[model samples]
Target: MFKSILVPFDGSQGAEAALAKAAELARLCGAELTLLTVYRHHSLLEASMHMVRPDEPADLDDIMRTHAKEVAERGRALAAESGIPAPRAFVKGGPVARTITSFAKEHGNDLTVIGSRGLGSLEGVLLGSVSHKVTSLSETPVLVV
Candidate 1:
């Protein structure tokens, strides 16, 4: 019964499963599917650690955004193959859980399908998993795979 469906994908196995599930739901409900890849903003100190030289300039935000775009594209392709037509994808920079939930709310998506575990391990254990946070924050229904 969903009009629009949102899936938070991170190129992880769990995320892939969630995407597949979302695709099936979209296909059955005739709903549009949107794949979202969330990346955290990197600080100067964090960007510097990846640099090999003092003179080297790191465009960490751009790099991360590019990577997130790729991840979203992959999810979109998978959804297409699963019979979800015209699936759209987006890359956003922010806190992962908040970004996902806010995007779903802002877009008026009726349902959100997300992975129970993503790339985060320490943060998941310490602060709770992103899926858990999303379920707590989102007003829409969330299905964690």
Candidate 2:
């Protein structure tokens, strides 16, 4: 039985499906649940694309972090609604697969339940999906929904 379960969520339908599965497992095992949302670091060019003002320089990291936090919190709320009590949420900026695996290891999570697909870039489609990379990299077992 899993004692700690991690779910990497991206606010997509696939992620929601994974979350539902993870929540059920958590409830069954009486495990602690954590919802993780990872956002990529924005380069200056990418940041400029999202800038609100033409001349104003916004802190892209902060902007992205805030949005990521919201995504995590939403996932936590969904878990709670699914009867998973007090689910924890975390947001980080990094390569999606690496960040998820690192967080699971760092937090001593016993299992990871993730979506088959997420809001991945074209590069991910060309190379491999984030879920695929996570499954390959993680020592803990990964269940792809």
**Steric collisions counted per model:** 0, 0
What lDDT is reached at residue 100 by model 2?
97
Across residues 1-145, which tens digit of lDDT does each residue of candidate 2 receive?
Answer: 8999999999999999999999999999999999999999987787767555656556778888998988998999999999998899999889889999999999999999999988988999899999999999999999999
TM-scores for all candidates: the values are: 0.93, 0.93
Q: Model 2 lDDT vs. the true structure?
A: 0.93
> Which candidate has the highest lDDT of all?
2
Q: Cα lDDT for residue 87, model 1?
A: 92
Candidate 1 lDDT score at position 14: 93
Candidate 2 worst ten-residue window by lDDT: 49-58
lDDT values for all models: 0.91, 0.93
Candidate 1 local Cα displacement, residue 145, angstroms: 1.0
Clashing residue pairs, backbone N/CA/C < 3 A, model 2: none
Model 2, residue 135: displacement in angstroms?
0.6
